[model samples]
Target: MHRAPRKKRRWPKILGFTLLGVVILGILAVVFSVQLNNGLRSATGKDTPVDTAVKSQLVRGIEAKKTGDASHDALIDKAAETLQQTPMKTITEAAGNQQKAAELVSQTTGVPEASAQVVTQAIFNDSKFDGVRKAMANGDWVQVYQQGKTLSSDPDIQALTRLVQ
Candidate 1:
């Protein structure tokens, strides 16, 4: 027996749907690429003024810090000079000397050295030692500390040594 006319297969419908899906994906890709290009352009271009303003502010801040530091150093140097000129013969003189010595230590240790203030404190803190304090006050650190080596056998010194090591 002959067969009736055959119905259309579903393959064409499946193929059409697939093609539509591919076209939609292609459109989305183009749109995404255009958005990315716009974003990059906005990020990089036409921002020269804002960048310059930010740089200028940073430069101003740096300049202000430098000026303040220079002034502070000048004041410290002046104070140190005054303390150094004062003789160290009397107890008061020795006290001032100790202050200068401490300042020297602080200066030698600190990056820029807070000399004047440190020296004043050292002199003010004098009276803790007798002749040795006097020696340090007179800026005889080498002799005074050399003598201190004899006293360095204490547990405090040992503990400090171990901690540093």
Candidate 2:
């Protein structure tokens, strides 16, 4: 006797379930991403126009320094002026977040995080460079040299001193 042919297994159910799982995973991924972005924004606080401008200027300064371009000193001076114009509280907060900022800069510029941190801290926190900023604004090389002499021993300040001069 001839055996009856077996019915082919239907794959629509398996295909449907797989599609559903993929869609669910995609939705979850989107939701997770949105939540993460919101959390970071809340943690970092609101970014103002000045904050944007300052960050852009700081990045430009970093790029200039990395390239050793002729625009290096001008870019750094512009960043300092922008920082000086920003509120003290904002400046303090930026300095406090230097590590995070460095990570971001590293990601964007492909610079090492340690080097980015050095630049960020020197730009935002190192009080030794305040005189340099002032001297830059005043076009006073004498004051820049005086302040540089005092801070020459500090590696961070030395880096900033090199940038300024």
Candidate 3:
């Protein structure tokens, strides 16, 4: 007796193509984000007058933050400036010795060594700061943060305030 013809399976092929399409879209999104970020950096670069022009055209909503005291704001700004200037390599190398790191942070930010240790540890191994490290791996953390009237979602600048407290 002759056997009936078997039906072709299409679900596997359809599923694979759908997955491939999703992956392609995801990659495209990542590339687009990177490109946009790079463009933003060039536009806002410190070395150029473009930054001033661009900033001037935009509405400035974020004023300098004050912790209700002049001395406190000064302390916070000092710590922020220290973190803003320090490179990732310096931070990582200093982290190799917790004491050294704390000393460096204390000297740079003018905070007490004990407070510096806390800030240094947070920068070195805290899970909460992992995102900040990744964003600032290139050492130019300015990309991931904003100071003065700029807006930033990165917790790094905020985290530095812990040093003063």
Best by lDDT: 2
Over the stretch 79-146, how does candidate 3's per-residue lDDT look in tens digits? 55555555334553464566777887787867898899887787677665554454443323344343
lDDT of 1 at 73: 54
Task: Specify the poorest-scoring 10-residue window by lDDT in model 2.
Answer: 87-96
Give the higher-lDDT candidate: 1 or 2: 2
Residue lDDT tens for model 2, 1-165 = 999999886798899999999999989866564344334545667544434554565566555554455576666565555544544334333334666557655654567888988877866575766766555333333454577577768887678567766
**Deviation in Å, model 2, residue 18 alpha carbon:** 67
Residue clash pairs of candidate 1: 99-119, 99-123
lDDT of each: 0.50, 0.58, 0.55
- Per-residue error at 53 for model 3, in Å? 12
Off by more than 4 A, model 1: 1-98, 111-131, 138-146
* Structural similarity to truth (TM-score) of each candidate: 0.26, 0.26, 0.36
lDDT tens digits by residue: candidate 1, 1-165: 999999989999999999999999989866564344334435675323423343344345434433346676565455444334333222223344555455455553453355656545643564434545654444344445564665456576578656743
